[model samples]
Target chain A: MTFKKFWVMAYRDLLRNRRRTVITFVAIALGLTLVIFMNGLITGMLDGMLRDTIRLDTGHIQIRAESYEVVKTSLLWRDLIDNADELAARAAAMPEVAAVSPILWASGVLGTASESTSVRVSGIDPASALFDPIREGLRAGEFLSGNGRGQILIGQRLADELGVGVGDRINLAVGNPDGVPQEGQFTIVGLINTGFPGIDNANVFLSLAQAQSITGSGNRASTVRIMLHDINDTDKVVAALQTPGLTVMGWRQLNEFIMTTMETGTAVYSILYAIIFLVVAVIIANTLLMAVFERTREIGILAALGMKGRQIMTMFLFEATILGLIGSLFGIILGAIVVYYFSINGIYFGDLGDVAGSLAFGTSLYTTLVPANLFLMAFWMLVVIVTVSLYPAWYAARLEPIEALHAL
Target chain B: MAAIELEHATKIYTIGEVETRALDGVSLTIEEGEFTALVGPSGSGKTTMLQLMGCLDKPNSGTVKINGQDVTRLNANQRADLRREKIGFIFQFFALVPVLSAYENVELPLLLNGVGAKERKERATALLEAVGLADRMDHRPDQMSGGEQQRVAIARALAPRPLLVLADEPTANLDTANGEQAMDIMARLNKETGTAFIFATHDQRVVAYAQRIVKMRDGRLVDGNANGSAK
Candidate 1:
């Protein structure tokens, strides 16, 4: 028989049990919707975390001394990058390089009149692009403006613990970059709150010149941070900046814990989605199997009327294809709507108590719909639906006409 | 050449170590354009004989032929092709595809034969009108009465104009009036189309309409002679 006849026959068979077909269709659509929606939310969350981490903590790439075993802010000048200024200037001249920041760091104690706490003081250039996020996050006083003025920026969390506000005097003590212990009293110029409590609780920022003066490390910083026009260019830029005595690292390696967590989470999410898909496939298979069994007599009539086994099988497969197409179309549309809504109006996790701080990213979780993912999912579900239908189709095709005609 | 010839045909049904013969070494020949009826009570193998003649079953140790071509040696698909090209079938319950209209059901055989749309339409329409159901062309089986559905089945059986048509208890489900009406249509179709028909039935009214009657009892033909005149 022609394919058109087969289609008409298969469609009529589907209409025979309209309620069952509708229920199975809804199962497939809802399964696919959950996959799409969950994948979008997780992708958006991971991408947002990576972007914010690169923005607030690690740049696209960083260069440090080869001898530096651990990344800690210590005032010991032995492991400092002595020619950081020259290196930063050369890197800044590269076309692919966006901005470079030279940072001097010291493990220190920030002391108020009645309290003191251990802290890591990061020294930065106020006007550089690297400090733009923090500059925007200045909640109280102004950021450090010049090279010589004694000023410091403390996180709002740290300031709260120290019971100090803007313009208050705080004393800092650290081992000098020359290997001698030194102390400095500076005015707290600004308070910073970047929403990430991990950074806010223990971080203090000062101008590079003032940090070097207090640490007694002349013309040297601990690291030179590089931001590129695109983070995907990390490998190329890292290769270009491969100096003999300097170690270059990308954000992925620097934030290995976060990256590993994201990967594991994604894998787990996919397995869960696959389980749900499998359940939907089972439902479809069961429905088709029941249909074949119920229509044994009809199949016998067709076979006795001269339909080949292949033709009978084709008819059943065509029915499954139609069902899959309808379910997947609805799935894509509904999933896209939900994803788009979440993308615009993010889900807030702030009420869950420093959720961003724990995750080391923003608190609001948005969803992003990747069109390729939607298409791939639709294709996969269709393949699965048709593949699972083969068993029932084959069963129908192999049925003996005489026996089937006598079946109840 | 005979339209159908069954020589020493045997069919056995087995259920859990119990074997019973349904057709036992029965030999019969049906010529072209013959209106024959295989009449018997239950367990008389009338239905089994019709099934064998329709290419629906293989005889255990005997040969069956249609149009001078041996069908006993053909495999399943080959037999199905032969059935498609050379044989038609009608069932007791008027097994019309419940989803299809009367027209499409009649058009089914021609479609299977790869007939073009224009010819298919003309042939199906003529056959439905011949069966006196032209006005009910678009109605599904449920929308029609038992007699009308059976007439559609008759039109479908004759649509391909096969060398032979096998119908098993074709009017068993119809009332007396509908049964007589169906018999009248089949008899007229046989006369007009010159297509041979062999039906297995116990209904006396149906047996009376057949031009030839062969009676069987307990898996064996009791009367080998054909009464060519209607009773």
Candidate 2:
């Protein structure tokens, strides 16, 4: 028979039992919507965490001494970049570079008269745009000067825990490059609240010059963090800043743990998506099988009218395709709307954010809509729907003409 | 050449441990343009005989030919092709595809035969008109009366202009008036198209319209020659 006639017959057959058809449509739509929404939420959470980490901790790229070990928080002059100013100047000249700052990292203890805690101290160029989040997060007091002495900024959460506020005199001790502890009394110049618990709970900041002088590392900083105008330009800037003695690292390499976690999470979600698709497929297959049972005599008539078994199979598949196409279309629209809404107005998790503090998860989670993922999901749903329908179609096709005609 | 020839055809049915011979050494010949009836009571295998003649089933032993081509060795697809090209069928149920309208039902066989669009439309329209269903062409099977649906079935059977039409019962569900009306339309169409028809029925009114009668008892022909026709 002509393909057009097959489609007409299939469509009309679906309309014959409108309620069942509609139910099947809803099943497929809901199944796809659930998956799409889940993917959107997960995408948003991962992307958000990565963005926050890049903003508050790592920049788009970091240039450090070839032998520098971040885990060790090393203060040896050999482990620090001595030409930080020159590297920062070269990177600042690049149009792709949004901001460049020389930062010296040290492991230190900050002690008030009543309380003490180990903290990661970041010595930063106070005027650099890379510190914009910290400046914007200044909850109290004033920001430090580029040439400030014996001054530091502590997180609001840390300040709350220590019962110390701005202008509170605190004793800070750090290991100098010579391996002896150097102690200095510093006044807390500002209180910052960046909303990222990883940063706000355990970090203190000071001017680059003060940190360098206290550490006895002459004119040396730990690393030059560079933020790009577009993160996609990280590789290009990294290539531009390729110096023989310094190692340039892009965001992907710097955030290897998060990338690995995302990959593992995707593998787990794939199993979930397959289960969802399989359930939808089973619903489709069951509906078509019931249709075959109900239309046995009609199938006999078609067979007697010279329609081959394969043609019969094709007709039922057409029915499935019609339902799938319309259902998936509706599903994609509904899913996009939901994802878009969540992307704008995020879902609040409150203290749940601190559970993943090390990953820089924020206080609220937003969804991200990836159009290609939506289409890919729809495509796979269609395939699964059609594939699962083969059994019912085959059953209908294999019905003996005389025997089917005998069926009531 | 004969339109159909069945020689020593035997079909057996095996239900669990029980075996029954549905058709036993039934040999018959039907010439082109002949209207014949295979009349028998229930369990006489009249329907099975018609099924074999229509290529809807294969004989266990013996050869059945359609348009002088041996179809016993043909595969399922080849048999379907042959049936599409050469045979048509009508059932007691007024077996119109319920989802399709009367016009599409009539056009179905033609579509299967891959008839061109213009000719398919013309022939389907003309056949529906011939069957007196031209005005009801847009109606689905449920919308049409039994007689009307049977007429649509008749139109569908002849759409491909097959060499023969094999009908099983055909009028068992119709009222007396509708039954006679359906038979009258079939008789007229049979004469107009010059297509041979073989109907299996116990209805006297249906049998009265046939030109030849082949009566069956159990699985064997009770009268007529080896050709199973009283000429």
Candidate 3:
């Protein structure tokens, strides 16, 4: 009951200065809104990057020869998986596996008579569902066939850069498994525009059989890339595919750089959030201090009426709690609306796509709504507001009744 | 037993390098049920004397007793507890909490004392009716006239059933009629409740309502009977 009266007093006191109260509320709301929006945008951008990398490049998990080194593009027979088809079939039999394909990776150069550029060549089973995104992205020509000879599928960006089109012939030179340079003339049977600059800028795909024949690595593959029904099932599938001479890796291991960057980004954004909260906290503290100054005589009356110092402080803290709760509620609503809009129609980064091509970031970035983050932000905002209000509350509580009553 | 006792209490105020004796070796006693006034000129220490007696401040040299318990040695919180349980105050400014209605202002002390809800409402309503503010119970201080606010303050002071009520120039801001109306209400309530009243004022009309008047000059009691007419 005493608490009820204190709450009543606090609530009415806020109403006494409606304009100031509204202004303080706006400060807290805007501060929290900005934090939530930034959190959503950053989380979306990073998660989108990771998703794109996994979809277009890493898959959920990969099984490769134990001696294989991806950076070296080692085409040595000893470094390649000899029973690649058998391993792929084994993985495809698992219920957790969404798609399984034996892929051959090689470093090569594509020439169009006027220009030549380095590219990563992917030899894939065109029938595998794991390449569905690439198949769906076929811009001008049909997708590759399993038995097509001397045919390749290149990103529209790569074709545009090389001044080539579908059905155009391009010369590809690669090192065979015997360390001999092999050259072949292949037709760009299809062009793909996946909207991912990393893939569009430097990747070319061909049938796995033809790739093995050209590289003189018969029945061999660089790795068996497996896509899971759910990314969480990567560990289960990997455990089921643990063979003696193979190394199984999950997407997290393949994309360790992105994961590390995300962790570091979280720490940096936490400091940014702290700075934002501090700014809001100072505004709240200043507002309560002004209220304390204005209510000096009233405080004296309350003290003379037998309210202890701590009780007086509790009243002010209650005021802050009310302000914080309502303000943050509005902030969460506004922030969620903004984030949802951006999540649907992403924010466009036209040139940044090309700049961040190596990171597999798309041209447009979307937001992800994490309910926990929104609530956490609101909770911390309330905590900061109440914590900072302590100084003004303490000042009011320590006032001497006689001196305060004498104040004008 | 005396409602309040001050024995050779002295209070000094210091500012910068200067010192002023606000109260000097003053001793006084007021028994329960006495209506008294401390009359003096400006800076003559009437407010200081009332502050010491009210437990708002501790004297620099002497002891103040409220309900025969030594209050000068008590800490701030202890003094607040004593004030809440044993005393009440009315200010010259009609110090009703501006945000609260008259009824709420009167009920604030009772709420602080943790009185039950039903009893709190009954006592607050009865007191407001007694002060002739039964219709003005819903009016905030800003919405009411000075006289009405003062009457509200009076009701609030007596709401706690305190041993004494201290009023400092209770009518300083009211007109002649409002002042007399406030004084009549306070006099009637004092007689009816049998609660001690100590007011620090220079108004002759207000002093006339006091059953015993103690005069002060330069922080010293001028009356030969330091105990006042209560003796």
Top DockQ hit: 3
Tell me the whole-model lDDT of each prediction, alpha carbons only.
Answer: 0.87, 0.90, 0.90
* Per-prediction TM-score: 0.84, 0.92, 0.90
Best by TM-score: 2
- By DockQ rank, best first, the candidates go 3, 2, 1
Predicted complex 2: CAPRI docking category:
medium
List the lowest-lDDT window of 10 residues for candidate 2 chain A.
Answer: A353-362
DockQ for all models: 0.56, 0.72, 0.82
Worst 10 residues of 1 chain A by lDDT: A353-362
Better of 1 and 2 by lDDT: 2
Model 3 CA lDDT for position A221: 94
Better of 1 and 3 by lDDT: 3
TM-score rank, highest first? 2, 3, 1
Give RMSD to native, each candidate. Answer: 4.3, 2.8, 3.1
Q: What share of the true interface contacts does candidate 1 keep?
A: 0.62
* lDDT tens readout by residue for model 1, B1-231: 788888889999999999999989988888899899899899999989988888888989788889888898988899888888888899998798888999999998889889999999999999999989989999999999999999999999889889988999998999999899989998998989999989899999988888888999988888666323342
Q: Could you give candidate 3's per-residue lDDT for residues A1-408 as a string of tens digits?
A: 889888998999999899999999999999999999899999998898888878878899999989986455788888899888899999889999889898998889999889999998889888889998888778888888877688999998899899999889999998898889899999999998776776788889989888888888898999999888899988888888899988998999888888999999988999999999999999999999999999999899999999999999999999999889988998898888888889999888786765655434366778988889999999999999999999999999999998888889
Instruction: Give the poorly placed runs of model 2, Cα more than 4 Å off.
Output: A69-72, A108-119, A135-148, A154-173, A178-197, A354-362
